[model samples]
Target: MTIRTRCGAWLATLLLLASSASLQANTPDDQLIVGMNMNNLLTLDPAAMTGNEVVGMVVNLYDGLVELDPQQLTHVRPALAESWDISPDNSTLTFRLRDGVRFHSGNALTSADALWSMRRVLHLNLAQASVWKSYGFSKANVDQAIVAPDARTLVIRLPKPNDPHLVLYSLAALGSMVVLDSKTVQAHAVNNDWGNRWLTTHAAGSGPFRLDGWQAKDVLTMSRAPDYWRGAAKMQRVVFRHLQESQTLRLMMEKGDLDIASNMAIPDVRALRDDPDLSIDSVQRGTIYYLAMSMKDAHFANPKVREALRYLVDYQGINKTLMAGYGVLHQRPIQSGMPATLPDPGYRLDIARARALLAEAGYPDGFDTTLRVLADQPFLNVAIAIQSTLMQAGIRARIITGTGNQIYGAMRDRQFGLLVGRGGSGVEPHPHSSLRSLVYNPDNADSARLTNFQGWRTSFYDAQLNRMIDQALTERDAAKQQQAYFAIQQRYDQLIPALMPISQMVDSVVVNNRVQAYQPHPSATTFLRDVWKTPESLAGGTP
Candidate 1:
């Protein structure tokens, strides 16, 4: 058969599979087959998780004391611990574990398991270790910090009186403070690896679902827990197929083989915007897409030249056309809707002004520069738009593209001229979370590799900004904290660092009409807890 003919037959097979799945949904939809690009998933072990995809999957397979509020993205709500209490000094937090919760291994959930899970994260010092590090956590002091008076009572004492809001918010984060059945984990432990090897593929938690199967860079499937604490899951199983190609996702979405098309191409999303069978939903993410200048490059070292590039960026044009309504102009490290975020300065594209600035910077004939971007749209297309505008001011710009790691590794190594990156260190919806990770840098030692702090990656450091971040984080008064954050925003604008904030990221997910209550959070997390299917739709052969 020809290529097109073979492709048609392949789609026919998927449609047939989808139809077969519907035959098993007579009792409240047995499954939800989702199409996603899951190549970024690294590990199923909560402490080793780095990708949001892994976190989302593990979220269903684990539970923390607290969780992000379903409706309010910035707030927290109870999870494993039905209720909690605080000491008068604000340094001690105590939680009361819900009774009768059971792990997949039939072990009962308790405060002992909660303490063990956190200690494991600290002992391993893995991906989520920083959450504890923020509060003076150390391997030597782990036992003193977390205490379990009994199986039902868990308490944590911080070295300092930290903000309760920040503390709870940090704990609510997935992969940060999730619990594991200590007995099950330790039973499989070998040579102090803390069951990290086995837990990477297996789960030991009292959660909504239990891991059924996982294949790296391929597929991950989960079945509803037999006795979930809340109730039986709405869907019996969730199947995440690794379908990276947008064309394949689009065809599957059209054929009702996939329930949700996550990571859909902008062009495909737009084309299906008006389709009755599909629904396109979007949320303004906390990610900030920006251009960073390598301080090592002499051309970018000039202040006026850097300023000229800011004016050269056509944010409106790029957002309207190339981004296809998936980009919002956000010009600060502090994400929009944040309390201390100042009004955008609204710098318009003025070629005459850019030319004047470039001349003042001693480049009367403009200069040549390279703009590094990832080999993907939105990044590649946005870089092209920037190249077009910079040329008007005689700036000869070249675009270099590479895979995600190749480009990020270059940024980490500080070996590029200029690069456009998407970051969310400042988007924890907290000023300290944003500033410390994006703009504040106090340590520049060879031993201090704050890789999560993108500001450190750009080789930009200011002593005053460093002190300001420290003050803001420690200030207890609400008004003063807000002022400190506002002040940093103003100063960051005046002394443009290695970054030029362009726009905030907006995520688009096209789902079938059968997918109800499809709430995609600001962090780009997908939750199906409240999602249900219509009886008729569930019985239908097609989505």
Candidate 2:
């Protein structure tokens, strides 16, 4: 049979299987399936993966030094390393490896493994630059990870005395510092590309779960590792199916075919909240939804045009209408809850002010412009709202929709005048990653230099960011550190590189009552290690 015919047959089989699967209570222990609305898996390689879905899947299969508690923002507990100590001078951090931990290949983890893993992150190739830069490690210092006399001890030497957050950077490096079998990596060193080739499809971690099988853009299946350091995971198997649309996911959840579903549409989320049979988990995430303008675009170069466009936005109205009151209107890049030295300086929606600014910029009647947006329904709705708002202010704005990846690529290359996108940091939040990627030159500057979308470059802002980074490294006073962060936020507010609509986005997770200990984090990611099924609930418990 042809390849297309074979694929078609497989799809038919999946449909039939899905139909027959029992999503209701009293389902057998081995038949439970968790449905999720995840898009295409960008990459299986932890180093190369960037999307939240892919990272979430990988998180279950890999172990890091510290893990975040979903309920508390500041709390971090041990995962791979049982305990650690920092030198008084703050130049050295020593981690003691957890005993009895073994990789998927049955190799015991040692200090050498941790050293190799962190060093590789520091020297990450082009394919993994996005993940690596988030660790706040300079290339020179990363090359200096050293092992102590004890085989179980791993020490990282800093160039200078830094702060606790800098050390915490290691814990929250996300896909960057995942420990790998040192022997296997060395054996394959001569023939493999560490970041792109070997690690992309194959993983050897000491996490509770192991990668059993993976099919691109389809399903990724993992099973509990029997010899996991913390003991065998309670759930025998975990499957992640890449169902892209919200409607299909909701349908599956309603039919009792999925035990958990995330990223629900706003309307669907509201419905799920009222559903008697489902328990909905919702959290306001620390992600910013904003419109990015290409600084290199001549039309946006005029400060008056930029200010007018900012004024033309009605963030409150968009939050109320599109988000169904689920979003918080944000004024600055930094969200409100974050401990910073300054408060948010909110924006104003003044039609008269916008028109005046446009007139002053030599366009009393406004001008024509195009804004690229994601083809997703909610994002499109937002784009349409923005377009209408701008038109009302005499600016002729058109919305062009495409896949998220396509729009992001165009925006990065400065090929689009304006684009609506989201920006965020992981559990260990930091601004350097976005600063380096969005503001600085692209990875390969000699070829096609990626210009900062807002063309914003001020020595003042740069100095503030630098000071914050250095203070985050060595400062011990919590209040003082927050002051520095506040200053950084104030600088960002002044620059207005991007108009932030919402400080936080609402993420919803729907799960069957049978599934216990399902927790959601502000990052909109879950640590599924502690998730388990209750026997009583599985045995025909009432909804």
Candidate 3:
């Protein structure tokens, strides 16, 4: 590992530099090879998908009604739906489907297929279901909610008014509203599985690219869709090799073996800032990295203990030195771009205050606890910084590092004490977008199994928070909505639910200088259709 890397435990990550040989063809000028950190890819079925890696890949193979701009989340543009109209009450929407759009399976895109795809989400009750269920969509009423007025017209009728922007935002989100070749999926269905299992490996959508083949822990390859709905992609082929080592990715970029390194370690990313042959792309993503204290844990069940632990976090020390330029200091669940975002309380490490709060909560001396963290840079490094700072207040946090699934799975199962995890999709730049996940969970029902809501995983329930989130989302009056958000923040700060904001993330990528028009999406979405390469990089020459 390079100097100043957060953790020394995983320095062995450098050894892969010699082992990871180039996987791309030397003269494949029309190809874009990406190096991705593919760890928790669970499924490809749009209805049953959850992980970001799988959704990002499948999104290229599928078409939704609308999609967020690749450069920002400020607007949603038409995709499969050429135009749409919303009812004045904000409960009904009618969409006009684009003509001549063809799925990879050679089926024509139709409103019926879009309706079926949506019903599949409700029937399967996957992660996307929370977005709908939260809006009163249920299994019994899902079919009723969706209607096909004609082959090219689709209508969705909501039982109650909702934020039209948020509803459209959900459609643009990962696996939220994907249109499938319904006939093909139904033909492949086994035991009425809706092709959920078959789709885990095969794909059926109308996007710029279609799946050629995929292997877990190996590589995933795609070929440009022929006569794609939008147009043929600039690159004829795209390959994502699953390599998690920072040194190997850097070596590949140096040798011109890889066209783009999709992700890299923070230390290596910072080191490449001055490299002439490379381009650094980064953006503040719609996510928050934080330390979660499970309410199930007896010690953390005390609200004062949770608040005390928050003050113990040295946010400035971590963001400036350890986290450095990769992240920024943020305190609230609402991300930077969203409306009604308040200033950070700016709480720094206060050992004296922490001790006082702990005493007031009946723990005169600080308590011992475990802080499960991902075994990687930034996360482990941040965990270490927090541990050292907590020790000043006599709070001992035993660090446990593991893969993301292992650590986050503990949070989902409510089997953890404390974990360093990231939460909130922030799909819409709305206050409720983050609040719904961070603290709005009202009941830990089976439906709450949606990992999008981390509060459910931690058994953090607040009836008032839930009501406030709903009210704020539907409130059309700007000032009243802002008031609702501000009041919600006050209550959340008081109750000390699940998580403590560590930092606002800035996702980075190291790409060859020849890679052009490569804009990073706010959600870390990789839409390579708009990306192209110059003559130099295409000819396997130096950038």
Instruction: Give the candidate number with the greatest TM-score.
Output: 3
Q: Least accurate stretch of 10 residues (summed lDDT) in model 2?
A: 452-461
Model 3: per-residue Cα lDDT over 105-157, one tens digit each = 78888999999999998898876688788777888998888999899999999
Ranked by TM-score, the better of candidates 1 and 2 is 1
What residue runs in model 1 are displaced by over 4 Å at the alpha carbon?
1-28, 366-368, 536-543
- The sequence of per-residue lDDT tens digits that candidate 2 reaches over residues 1-543 is 454664465455455555567444233343236666555466677666666677677777888877666677556677787888888877677888787788877788887787777666556644454434433455666666455557788887755555555446535545556677777766656444554566666567777787666667677667777778787777876777778777888887877677787766768767777778788777766566777665556767677787888888777788777866346676555444654524445566679999998899899988888888988756788888888888988888788888866887676555777777775443445443333333333233324332232223111124555555555545677776666656656665566554444435666678877787778766534677777766644465322
Instruction: Estimate the lDDT of model 1.
Output: 0.78
Q: Which residue runs of candidate 2 sit more than 4 Å off their true CA positions? A: 1-27, 30-32, 126-128, 131-141, 146-149, 160-162, 185-190, 341-343, 429-474, 498-501, 536-543
What's the C-alpha lDDT at position 527 in model 3?
78
Which residue pairs show backbone clashes in model 2? 23-256, 162-473, 162-474, 163-473, 163-474, 295-453, 341-486, 342-486
Candidate 2 has what TM-score? 0.86
Q: In terms of TM-score, which candidate is stronger, 2 or 3?
A: 3
Tens digit of per-residue lDDT, candidate 1, span 1-543: 453663464455445655675665322255677889987777788888775677777777888898876467677778888999988767788999889999988898989899999889889988777656756787878888999999889999887556666777777764557899999999999999999998988888887887776767767767678888888778877778899898988877876767887888888888887889789888777677888887667877677887888899987777777776567888888888877888898877899999999999999888888889998878998888888898999998898899878887888777788888887544355776667667866665535776666777777777898778777876878899999888988888887678888888888888887777778766534566556665544444432
Residue 318 displacement (Å), model 3:
0.9
Rank order (by lDDT, best first): 3, 1, 2
lDDT of 2 at 464: 52
What overall lDDT goes with each candidate model?
A: 0.78, 0.64, 0.79
What lDDT does model 3 reach?
0.79
Candidate 1: give its CA RMSD in angstroms: 5.6
